[model samples]
Target: MSTTPLVLLHAFPLDSRMWDGLTEPLARRARLITPDQRGLGTATLPDTGAAPSLDDAADDVLAQLDQLGIDRAVVGGCSMGGYLTMAVLRKAPERVSGLVFIDTKAGADTDEARANRLTTAERVMREGHQGWLAENMMSVLVGPTTHAERPEVLARVRELVDAQPPAGIAWALRAMADRPDSTATLRAADVPALVIMGAEDQLTPMAEATAMVDALPNATLATVQGAGHLSPLEDPESVAKTVLDWLP
Candidate 1:
């Protein structure tokens, strides 16, 4: 197997810790780097007064690669991480050797969705807490199978969500709300791609996964059984197996 580094970006309101389960297995195959995006985990939000931009987030990822002396890598992400993956592809396509998109779509948010995200960001900032996200997002984040059989996973997810700083969460919401449609980018991508989705992922279901597969000239879809939007966390074994099989 090739040893090209694999950079796995995390989901929204989550950190690099989300990939903990896949780390060891994947590391045996290739070098793995899971950096916490700005304002999310241990990373501090820059004091810059500028607005949130996925492009800037992408730049941050690329800059990290620069610091590490990695010239190229396979970039992949889940949900919000997927958005950032596309941003990186757009901002610096030459740096990416492959693409892995999990439980995410290539289209921009609908107007209503954008507005809702903006509203939520405002509410979280105003309230100075992210309890609402922790309370409301659990059901949507994991699938019914997880909810019924994996209560521990749900509790772990809640802890991860609750631990995130409100500022980071709010900034991520705004950045995601403004992300552009990446269908064209995928269509033009020259690298191999793997699009994975949870079997029961309601947020970006089979249709979304298939759409990405169809768009990529060289891509395949892997649906994780008994998982949802956060499939990596809900069913890491299956996800890791699929990814390991796909990796070169």
Candidate 2:
């Protein structure tokens, strides 16, 4: 980590700890400012009745930078965090120096996918985080290999999911479902960008990753083999190396 700081956003359903493996290495030449998404970290939801939107989530991240006296940083996020990184580009373009998008897409959810997320939200409100995780988490979030080879990873995932506040999850779940498509924004964003895809990612497949890379005017794509949706956990070393190589 350098004396100069950079902001790093955490993926939804997980906290900044997900970046733990890479922090020391990433911080080697740059300071990292990681925030737990609304309801996940020290940040909180707004008192206004405004329902949480993806834009709102991005606003929260930028707001954190303002709070810390940080004007801009190379923004990076995983999955939902990546989605928000795109949002940040749209909402706070001046604050972005670069982007690191991992295991996420720039398109809005399909009808079926949106419906499924809403259903998951309903269940989360009714039964809370565990029920939400039990029903929809494993199949979508964890790669098959990790579930088999690393019990500790799964356990850590469970701990992270289980630790979230019900209310926080409720708002974030809703926020994710309502996020706008950012394909256009990415295509227009002329910043240095890294599109990191998991070779075995089931959620955001290689096709989606390709679409993002193709759209971005200045971007490079790297694949982490033997990893899945949550590549940070399956191959943190690969993810770290990519980030390190990109830093100016």
Candidate 3:
């Protein structure tokens, strides 16, 4: 197996802690680096203006790589993390050895979606992430199967969401809202790619994942059945197994 490092970025409203389950299992095969993006987790986000961009977050990942003396590695992400992965590819293509995109899309947000995200950011800042997120995002974050069968997963998701700082949550929402369409970027990325999607994902469904697979020069799709947008957190073993099988 290749000793290339594996940097797995976390989704919005959560930090590097989300990847806890996969640490022991994936560590056996590769050096896993999971860092909290700027303004999230323990990492402090500098007082950048309201117009935060994923490029900045991408740069943070590259800085982390530099700190570790890793020239290149397979980078993977889920949800908002996928946007950061694409931003990394956009900014520093040579630094990426492979790509793993889980439960995300390659398209930019539509005007309506963008507006909604901005509104959510405002609401999160104003109302805080406590009641608003639990009420609004819980159902949308996970699939019906998890909602019906996995109460523990629901609790964990809630715990992660509640732990996020309001500013960080708001910043991520705005950043994601303004991210560019990554289809062309993916078309140009010549590295091996794995696109994992939840079979029951409400946000980015199978069609979106298929679209990413079609655009990439060399990419494969893995379906995580019975999961939602947060496939890794929903079923760590299945996602890890798919990743292990796909690793170069």
Candidate 4:
């Protein structure tokens, strides 16, 4: 093993391309792998009949690492990808050296949130991924601050998201709706970890990340001002720098 310790698995509503900004700097020394979750990017979608759950999503990420022949590596993720990283840490603790949780949390959706997620998932199913891609996804991803100030970043986020499969988006949203609460699991993981969030995040919000930080014994929390849910995209340079600083 070369001992390069990290692989970046990005969140939903986007693909591995979301990690582009952070890759060059991270690639210098860390063995980094940025993979699109199942059905999101170039990766083949799951059999429609057999959708993925949080556990299955975690398995998919581990499977990606296995295919790359990385025996042990740090795992980092954002948004839904961040939630899945928690699943990976739970299901394959031995394989994870550390974790980078960006704009994500360890809790499951509340009942109302779950209902809203289902509504979104159903919309993706009915309206088609491409349609949803153009409409809803564009608005909520980057906070209004980023939307007005940094059009380039917002454009990049849309460009990357447009490449995804509709079924993948629907499946992921449904899976997230039913994900198990992993606060207990996260609290138990005694590894070095980074829990980061955007100070002005509207979706996951900074308070959620704070609760997550409170539970993880070895985790450090970092906040980016004026950014939204997608910290890696909204402020990639700063996000990447924080990640590098956190790593051994």
Candidate 5:
């Protein structure tokens, strides 16, 4: 088996700590690098009054890899982190040995979605992540099963969301709003790809996940039952098992 490193990127607004559940198990199998994107967690970057592009975020990952002396690795991400993963594949395909996309879409935001993201960016900047989390945390982050059966998971999600920096949240919103469609990038990638989704992920539903799976030349889809957008948090065991089974 190849001993290439594995880089797992976290979802939006949350930092690398969001992957805590899967970290130990996955780390036993391979070297794992989970860096916080700019302005999130302890990773700080100067805010230039404009949102950084996905390419910029990808560059951050590349720079981190260089600093760690890793030449190539399996790269994967969840949500906004998935966007950065695709951007990395586009910008530096040589650095990627495999790909994993979790609960994310290959398409760019629609006009309405982009507008809403911008509006959200403004709101997060003005009122902070608390207001945004208050409105979206319970309803949008996890699935119905989590809502009905997993109060502990919900609490953990709350903690991760609460720890986010407002500036980082706003920056992520704007970056996602302006991100380009990555369907073409997905189509062109020739490496092994694993697409994992929560069965109840309303944000990126089954149809979207199916589309992503169909687009890739070599890809497999794993749907985690009883989970939602934050599947890693909602059902970390299943996510880790699926990922570990698929990894080389």
Candidate 6:
């Protein structure tokens, strides 16, 4: 196995801690660096008084690599993290050796979705993170199997969501709302790619995963049984095994 570093970006309204389960197993295979994107987790971005774009978030990750003295590495993400990964690929394709897109899509937000995101961002700013998580995020974060069989997983997800800063969450919502379609990027990518989605993922279902796999120049899809949007947490062992087997 190659010892190339791997950078895993977390989902929206969550932080680097989301990847905790895969850390040890993945670390044994390759160096792993998980960064809390701006305003999320421990990363504190100075208040710019404007909604940051996905390009800005992508630059932040590249800057992180520069700070760590890493020239290039495989870049991957889940959900919102996947958006950032595509942005990074657009901005600095030379720095990415491989691509791992988990439970994410290649299209831009629909107009209605963009409007919804703006509304959610405003609500978060006014009502705060906890309320937003309860009213808007909780239902879509997991799948039926997880809710029925894994209360602990749901609880952990809640804890992670609750811990995020409201400002960061709002910023992320706006960033996602404005992100561009990445289908062309995926089509052009020549590096090895792996796409993972939960069998029960509602947000980005198996069909969407299949579409992404078909777009990539070289890619494979792995479905995690009994998992949801947050597959890495809902079924960490399976996700880890798939990643370990797929990593270049």
Estimated TM-score for each candidate: 0.98, 0.94, 0.97, 0.93, 0.96, 0.97
Candidate 6 per-residue C-alpha lDDT over 148-228 given as tens digits, one digit per residue, 9 for 90 to 100: 999998888888888988988888999999999999999988999999999888888688888899999999889898888
Residue pairs with clashing backbones, model 1:
none
- Which candidate would rank higher by TM-score, 1 or 2? 1
Model 3 regions lying over 4 Å from their true place: none
Ranking by TM-score: 1, 3, 6, 5, 2, 4
lDDT of all the models against the reference? 0.92, 0.81, 0.91, 0.82, 0.88, 0.90
Q: List the residue pairs that clash in candidate 5.
A: none
Give the per-residue lDDT digits (tens) of candidate 2, residues 1-248: 34546566777688888888888777887878888887775566666788778788787888888888888788888998887888889998889887888899999988887888788778778887774484367676768778778788777777777887777877877888888889899988888888898887888889998999999998999999878888887788888888788775
Clashing pairs in 2: 1-27, 1-28, 2-30
Ranking by lDDT: 1, 3, 6, 5, 4, 2
Candidate 5 per-residue lDDT, tens place, 71-188, comes to: 9989999998899999999999999989999999999999999998889888888878774564475697789999999999877777777788888877888888889999999989
lDDT of 1 by residue, 132-177 (tens): 7877888789999999999999888888988999999899999999
Off by over 4 Å in 1: none
Worst 10 residues of 2 by lDDT: 1-10
Clashes found in each candidate (C-alpha, N, C closer than 3 A):
0, 3, 0, 1, 0, 0
Off by over 4 Å in 2: 1-4, 131-135
Residue 57 accuracy (lDDT) in model 4: 77
Candidate 2, residue 157: the lDDT equals 75
Give candidate 6's error at residue 115 in angstroms.
0.7
